[model samples]
Target: MLQLHPEQIAQRLDQLTELSVELGRGAAAGMLHGGDITPLLERIVLVAKDMTGADGGTLYRPSADGRSLEFHISINDSLGLRQGASAGVAIGVPGVALWQDDGAPNLGSVAAYAAHRRVSVNIDDVYQSGDFNFSGMRAFDGHYGYRSTSFLTVPMSDHEGELIGVLQLINAQDRETGLVKAFSATDQRFIEALAAQAAVALTNQLLLRQLEQLLESLVNLINIGIDEKSPYTGRHCQFVPELTMMLADAVHATTHGPMADFQLSENERKQLWLAGLLHDCGKITTPVHVVDKATKLETIYDRIHLVDTRFEVLLRDAEIAALKAQLASPAQADEITLALREQQALLREERDFLRHANIGGEGMSPADQERVRHIAQRRWTGPDGAERDFLDANELENLTIRFGTLTDAERKIINNHISVSIRMLEALPWPKHLQKVPEYAGGHHERMDGKGYPRGLTREQMSVPARLMAIADIFEALTACDRPYKKGKSLSESLRILGHFSLNGHIDPDLFDVFIRSKVYLAFAHKHMQPDQVDAVDEAAIPGYVP
Candidate 1:
């Protein structure tokens, strides 16, 4: 038997202790960062080989069905073989079966035996031992012209004593003569400790990833509900996040801007992405009719058809009066008929004018609004046999809406969605990395001058991601042609309005500048905007913009 001197034994003990410390530190750091566990697995095998002075090692994780041990990584310095270390090359070796077809544990393979028994198996030499099969190793050696010798297989288990993987090392070399030797008790103990640490780290990483995936699925579920509620808003929910990321990437890449110092880590980017997806989630609570108010006089249905019926009544009444007057005086029949024609022409002209006004276009001139009031003064007999104004109070209120289709009350209801979103998002218990989601999602509608909705937060109160979302949300709305009320504007038109907003303290000026200089709008336009809406833009012509 080969033995180490007292001094050599002491030096080996110190090295094993250091390796254990490094393994524990690495596992702890990986758990804290929530990164991939592949590196940790690779490190475990490396440490095992170092502890035993082994010339080769392989790590095996159980297959999904628990019926086989799949080769995850294999390293052989003597053979100059490195199969897996995150380089993604296929291992090319088949899995070691854990169970035979007879439904019995297959203890012939040393890795499988360790995994099934949940114990370490140390061999002085594999070619000389008959306890387990080494035929595969013999064949491998014959094919590669190498020797098959000492073997040490250890099972990795978590705290609950469930086997997670198996670590197998081969050909332990003597420190003095560089000859193959058996792994000692010290080597086995250190490897067993590392195996335990590795198992726990892998479990924690898998759990963390599962939780993150669950959160993302819930966010998507909310968006799907919103989509089923309204197709227009569903598109908005999808496009805004995409545009937000686009703008954020632009700001992150800019080196000369006011936001040059702004940077996003991987986790921070993920948080912002989730925030963008959920920004308009509160719209789900909004009344569908109010959100989809297509015309000025639209409710459950368009009330303009009722106005059309009223005009028809007036036309019939005018004809009946002409006929009665003709019957009363035969000589004045021609004059009465001519008067009837003129009256019918005037009524038709007014009716056409009202039809045009009902569209609720960009702006309503004062003269047009006054004309609607004048038309409302005409008397009409109701079905109840009482004379009433041509337009009801509600109809007058709706038709007189100066801007878009929504009235002030409906606008308030629409704006309340942001508040609802804030409440919903803030109710969730979030991790430290994602605690900013609510702030980023909720601050999209807030203004730079503190005149915005819900909280009316000023620019300084918001994060850069929040400001980026603001630009994204507004730009997507302006260029979107899917909305029921307004046609999408061209690139030049949207930029002009956005520039005005930048100067008017409606949005952050620095982000807006990045938005323009980076041409983020052009990228969004090409992807989501209509062909006609992607018009040429003159940077100098845009208002409130220096460029």
Candidate 2:
């Protein structure tokens, strides 16, 4: 038995009081530091050593199957050693089994005994004690030329009495004698209290990590839903977030310019990543046809085919009229046949013109639009025998669209996706660290000059992350060959357009500069762009860009 003097007891009491305060402070700090359990576990072992004057300590976490106690943390002050989970080193050793091969509690190893019994086990000296197996300890001490002494093993449990881990401290040294001695009852009591606190902290951190993983999984699920709705959009949803992070890392590494001082904490990085994944989640509500309109005259199917049938009908009618004329004037058959061939040639030319117009482009000239209008006025007899304009009102409207495949109403539907995304993200009950997710996700579509949609927020009103996302979204879209409406632009072309956008306030100039200077787009292109699409770029020629 170990006895303590009155003065020693007073000193220990003071240490205990201070240690309690330290534990509380550490737990709070751990929660803010990305809720990592490693720091907390390290602190637990260190605190236990300080309180008991132990020369070494080990923290064991039970395996998921509840069959063994694995070494999670180990520290030895005498040997100047730190290893295991907290030290970023694997133990590379098997855990102590709680049950023997026969399926009964072994109760041989001291740490396993403590965990199995859910109680503290204080030993004066392992070599002299036959109560628990000490063969491994003897072998370890022999190899290191050290003597194994006192041990105070405590079972950590949460508030509900669930086993969290087992903490074992060895060789408690005398306060004044500088010699190892048995751990006293006072030492065991204090260590038990510390272990309880550690258990609660560890449990809380583990729960927080689980919750964060759950949130990430939910975000991915939304992205998968968007992918299922449109196969082209899933890659965009994936690439934007990665590119946003790449640009963010570039800005973070920069030591000059307006973004030199910017940096992201662990929590901030996670928040931005989540925002990126959810940016286009609202596209799930978009109609598939509107999202994938490949040609100007496309709806459920290309309306150009229907127009071909009408041309065929007109050709047959012309041939029939020419034949009737030839029969009416047999002497003038050659003249009538020549006129029929000319009329057929004219109809074929007009049909080819309409076919060329049906495939949409970046822009359609006014002359082409007028030609579509003229073609629509020509007469065509349907199977119902009713003569009507060659192209109906809807077909004419779709065909004469001055830009990409979508009409004005369909463009509105596409633009509404961002608004819908904002609503969906904002409606969620987010934690304090992630509350900015809605703003970041929603701001990607907004322009720097406040000409953007949904809220018209200017650059100053938005965060750096929002601006970063805006650049990522545009760059990905510009170089994306998977889109139905446009082929992926070459690197120089994409950069030229991006540079123009930077000058026009379509995106943040500072971020655009960082994006270009860091060559972030090149990395993305190598991974996502076609081999032919990745071309050499001339930096000086890029419009509105400094470098």
RMSD (Å) of each candidate, 1 decimal: 3.3, 2.6
Tens digits of per-residue lDDT for model 1, 166-250 = 9999999986688998888767776777676667766666666778789889999999999998889999999999999999999
**What do the candidate models score in CA lDDT, each in turn?**
0.87, 0.87
Q: Which candidate leads the pack in lDDT? A: 2
- Residues 526-547, candidate 2: write the lDDT tens digits: 9888999999988888888776
TM-score of 1: 0.89
Off by over 4 Å in 1: 1-35, 62-68, 87-89, 97-108, 113-120, 157-164, 184-186, 320-331
In candidate 2, stretches whose alpha carbon ends up further than 4 angstroms from where it belongs are: 1-35, 64-66, 85-93, 159-162
Worst 10 residues of 2 by lDDT: 28-37
Clashing pairs in 1: none
TM per candidate comes to 0.89, 0.92
The local distance difference test score of model 1 is: 0.87
